[model samples]
Target: MNFDNLKNIYQFAEHFQKEEYWQNLFQHQSSNPLPITNSPSIKNSNIFPVCDMYQKNNYFYIDMELPGMDSNKIQVNLLDNNIIEVKGYYRSLQENCAYYLKERQNLQFIKQIALPNRVEERNLQFSYKNGIYTIYFRQN
Candidate 1:
């Protein structure tokens, strides 16, 4: 075979190998029942709230740490397919007042996450207290 033909065959084989590897990885992840932890981190630097989610029986529980946020400012929306959107604005009380030092960030942020399983839209529950937001969902 010519040099150009040989190079094309090698590239085709490499592409095929990568495709097979990715197919196997996806199959392994799907067949296993274990939860997938540690997804890619968000690129936002505005100190968005942290959240922990777990499934128990037919319900999913999500607890978020929202320090320095008021309950009235938080907004929750139940989108299609177990996706929830949490949005809120954080404004410093001393925005107008002169401050010597300021560490906290004053801005608006939104976080949206998809749950492992689908949930009943009407059965969703939410509670905010002590700088924490607890969201509960029941499976349909």
Candidate 2:
């Protein structure tokens, strides 16, 4: 090929290489957006008082501290792309009982978590005990 053709071919190959590199990088780094606590259930403003998440062998465990809440009041949902949402409410005492000082939070709260990897939706499980909500999922 002539010198001009050779140069043109080289330039096209260089451009293709740059595009491929960027595509690969994006594919590797792109991940689902993490869930945010923007939605608050008015009935329960003190939702998700404390939350923690960890991963083990083929499993993801989410533990949340939800004091003064009954088992029936809390709702847990798993969304597409491995997002977990916890929604619940806490009841307030009707009568004003005399107390020296009360500093505990009692309101509705909503917490959302983004999973590290896709999980089996059907295999999800939840347990509530001692005012703690624990959610378990099998990794996909």
Which residue pairs clash in candidate 1? Answer: none
List, residue by residue over 1-140, the lDDT tens digit for candidate 1. Answer: 23644565565456546665556556756565543323222224322666788888977888888776787778888788768888988666574578888866676778787777776667779888887888888766
TM-score of 2: 0.58
Candidate 2 contains a number of clashing pairs equal to 9
| Model 1: residues with Cα > 4 Å off, grouped in runs | 1-47, 56-58
Winning candidate number (lDDT): 1
* Model 1 whole-model lDDT (C-alpha atoms): 0.70
Question: Which lDDT tens digits does candidate 2 get at residues 39-101?
Answer: 333233322355677888977888887766787878878787777777776665546588667
Clashes of each: 0, 9
Model 1 weakest 10-residue run by lDDT: 38-47
